[model samples]
Target: MSALFPALLTASNKQALRFDGRALTYAELAATAGSLAERIEGAGRVAVWATPTLETAVGVVAALLAGVPAVPLNPRTGERELAHILKDSTPTAILAAPTDQLPPALAELTRIEVVVAGAADPTPERTLPQTDPESPALIVYTSGTTGPPKGAVLPRRAIATTLDALADVWGWTADDVLVHALPLFHVHGLILGILGPLRRGGTVRHLGKFSVDGVTRELSSGATMLFGVPTMYHRIAESLDTDRELTKALAGARLLVSGSAALPVHDHRRITAATGRAVIERYGMTETLMNTSVRVDGDPRPGTVGVPLPGVELRLADDSDGIGEIQVRGPNLFSGYLNRPDATAAAFTEDGWFRTGDMASLDADGYVRIVGRKATDLIKSGGYKIGAGEIENALLDHPGVREAAVTGEPDADLGERVVAWVVPTDRQSPPSEEELANHVAAQLAPHKRPRTVHYLDTLPRNDMGKIMKRALKSA
Candidate 1:
């Protein structure tokens, strides 16, 4: 496969990006990237800190085009986090937003070249260097639940394979316009949300940050595709009944995709009922952009994440009752983690398959169902092992509940008791605790029912829309 920038440039001469209010065609985008590439020649690593705008996009591709490894930093992160990454990666240059405020340490990196992008500059023409498939092209930081965030090294071949698989499975084309609201610092938004669309000559409209009102406006502006996580979809679903414009705007979208975490089956049904569009939930992670998806043409089962994409293999470890630790081996899998040889070695089995920490089962029709996380998220109570996600899905089906998260709480006799944090659609009209408890008992086994339900106005969430269960536990 060709280099990403070159492949994107060759796709078409038509408009490639729509940001804020302006349109930049493929020719124009390539010219900007090439111009930036000339000024940053010889830089071994380039770090970029900017919002998800067209200029930031160009800076990233330009660094790669110039044969430099691109490191994307979250603008909202603290200076300490920034310094640690810089120290570890030792980037030779930095490309940042033209903001007045910057870390003092950033100023002290005298040996590093810094370029303030999004400023006025003259465009220059330059040729991009040839890139090897094995060469590292992007480094994404993943904040582990317990340790400091580690940079996951993704090679050119891995990214290309992911995009190719997405295009083939979804039938992406230039006619599609993807409305992306997720943060670009993460893999889901960067690879599946941005790269996939651009590689197919499809247009992407970047919403700088997520806002229910702002997203409603973009959807009204005629975006054909929408990608988001479960939390974002829940908020949109809540706003659908009162926001006529949002309802009409979302109705125009041809596809609505959700991932990054398990999407509650209740949210899926509610979003479809409110907007007249079915939500397609797929399974993927930071290590892999996408692996399986609910088919667009077939029955989109609410609980199942659907079949694996072509060229991808899925097998359960230990093969106990068709449910086990999920393992995947494919072209799209990451080469390895950066600087953590031991962790990288442990991530794969002897046969080269990557061991996904998720526990899941495969149905007879080839659909994949995520049972729960292999670690803390799965609870054991009264000698019966239970998947918190299963009970969470049942609680979400309750009409009075807006959101729910199930976790294990300490118990004297049961070993662990199932507890839930719930957010109601109307705080003033909250359901009785007995009502919700009974609701779960009707839908689930006695062992799966939540012993305690705590109601909150909102749930703690990370930038990627994952509920921070640790925070909930502390609360």
Candidate 2:
């Protein structure tokens, strides 16, 4: 197999990565990561303490260069969750910065301090070992909504195919400078945000932590792209009207992408109205690196995640009403759950398509609009298969709503009745249940109106800014 990053070998003095205030040229990165790779060459598997710092990036790149599968452990993970991951993966060694204080869970494993400045006065033309494309590159764990988090083994082929597909769609090239401040444990932040730029031989500037000032500083300088989750974009939208600098910075960006959760239609309109730049939405799971994206050349549809990516085949299961579970078949899909053969076999259909539990619909133009998860967002009220996303969108369009989430409850007559949880813009004068119900009924069918409304100060959200509907339902 060819080298994953050919540019690393044909090294130049060009800047490859910038994290916080430190910068690394391609030459320096090649030398540093290459030397680190030599130290951990034969490890069965390695764990990277995935901090949003330069050392974490170097450690991951080193693991890749050594052809060892890397398991990225989140720093803020709970002790129980961390224990589960370490026990499940059973990595031979754990990699971290010299200054990092590891937890008790990792005390039993071998420690490898990843020093960024190890290769001093290093030369170019560094060598990287080649590995089979189908070999595991990274073992990323899922959110563990149902049970213990499962590690998804992603292959080098999946990474290459997914990044190349994104490049084709986004017009990504060496000239592009990417900017982001996202966690390193997930696919959206690490693989797409970090490795995507490296594959293009482009520059990546990591902000360490996301802030409006940091985003403005990078984009205003020379960064051409900004990658963020819906929460980050929401903050940007809130500040755009007052911060002329932020509006100008966002307007100047060549691309603004959102994923990991749905960007509310209200936020989308506000950002676009403020900066004259629309945010592109993409859809994927940890099991699938990326499936669909609103292309750079395509229409910027607010609700849709555009069409299937290059070399990907997507289908909707049981599409009687044009809404169904999204199933996909592509090289970009993960190999399987690390140790759970039963779960691995169950993830895919006999025909080979990976059954994504999320639900969505297809537009006439082949655009994909995600509705909600099958377990939480699809409410069967009065024998009607209603999607909570449309109702949430309608509720958000009203002036009083700040944040909204929808779920269903058992009903004697309706089988399930739609229930709404909202964070009103004005808590003192929150929209009455009748007004909100009528507001949704006006935009959609009367049957879709919420049978009950619960007002909250704020919606429960995960780290990625996705509303925890299950939590809301339980509450």
Candidate 3:
């Protein structure tokens, strides 16, 4: 019932957003976004060219101010995927930056170019227009593995509830400044990275693109938090040993969070070993903005994505040995897939819980350790439900192993035998199958160890750094 961001109407003119080199204060952002909202205030759904720039943020905020649902289109979206999204959402207008070279699919729609010029102005409403909390705020499309991408319609209440809940859990406040270089099309980067700071009345400094030097520069200056995927954090781990400034910068940060994919325990340990600060981990998807996170004051467990947020109710479905598909019910959950009532109905249970499709287990203390995806990462071998994530983590701990992913292959006796795809630390001398097998066996159970080993220079990964295990079945 409260305003999403009260600061837009009441806060002092302090810096709100800084992307690359450009900065905009709170008053400047309100004036710029407010002026734009007046033009398209009554439009149907609008599509935003979600590049990691100031324009994307402004367009989204303007859509919020205008009480319109904004669909964020990935700038690097392929022709097929772009076509699919455009066809599905049917946005009335496409919002982009002046310099954007848009694809042909968006050419037909009414284009709104977001331009924020000059410093903070003394023009802002004492009271902003009210929008229904149940109204759709954004329609974020999922990366369709089964078929064309399905749009997840997120409500205004979902965003507000999730951010406010995160604030309670993370001790977030107005003084905290966030620094990240995540993309704007996805929930983790856009909703949580950009919107979270704004909702908290804090500042966000985006790196445009992630760089070791850029991260260090921002954190060293005044930033208090860092949000990154495993790939970026892996690079940070690889560099922390020699890069004194990077290590120092990380150690000074109040919080470091990783999400969008499982951050291997090796990377987690490496970063902590270097900086004396544990990187907090959270779990979410396109359908759910955020469900759980490691509390800032709680123990920063290496492999765990901490307890459920304030109002989120989480329970495992069809559990055998603690691991099961995670189903959740919360205000933070999306309303449904846009224009797909059948698909939407299928995503939730008859009891109204959203099926997360990810397999995980809760620890004694309620910490969630996400094993992997149910379809690809849950390996059934030798009558054991072995999570591929644990085996992969064990394989990564090997001295000769640079990267690893585990899978289950069809077998006559075991139903499905465990297979390990490993990237060697050195290409010239890959670890033997037997040696690596024994290494995993020692770390985990014998049935959990890899029955066969395949060597590769790299693992196939998506934009979020999550290993595409489905691709490996063909190999």
Best candidate (score: lDDT): 2
Q: Per-prediction RMSD in angstroms?
A: 2.9, 1.3, 1.4
**Tens-digit lDDT string for candidate 2 (1-475):** 1277777876678888999989888878888888889889889999999999999999999999999999999999999999999999999999999999999889999999998873444554445567999999999999888899999999999999999999999999999999999999999989999889988999999999999999999999999999999889989999988999999999999999999998899999999999889999999999999999999999989988989999999999987677899999999999999999999999999999999998899999899999899889888888788889989999999999988989989999999999999999999999999999999999999999999999999888887788988789788
Per-candidate TM equals: 0.92, 0.98, 0.98
* Residue-level lDDT tens digits of model 1 in 1-475: 1367444455345667766765667766666666777777678887776467765677776777777778887888887788778887777766764552556656654333233233223343345678888888888887876677778888888888877776676667768888878887888887777777777777888776777887787777767888998878878887887998888888888888888888888778877888888888788776765788876676678888889987889888865545577899987777777888888899899999888888887888889888777776767688776777888899888989888988998899999998989999789999888888888889988677788889999899898888888889999
Tens digit per residue, CA lDDT, model 3, 5-34: 778876367899999999888888888888
Misplaced by over 4 Å in model 3 are 125-128
| Candidate lDDT (C-alpha), each | 0.77, 0.92, 0.90
lDDT of 3 at 79: 96
| TM-score (C-alpha) between model 1 and the true structure | 0.92
Error of 1 at 105 (Å): 3.3
What TM-score quantifies how close candidate 2 is to the native fold? 0.98
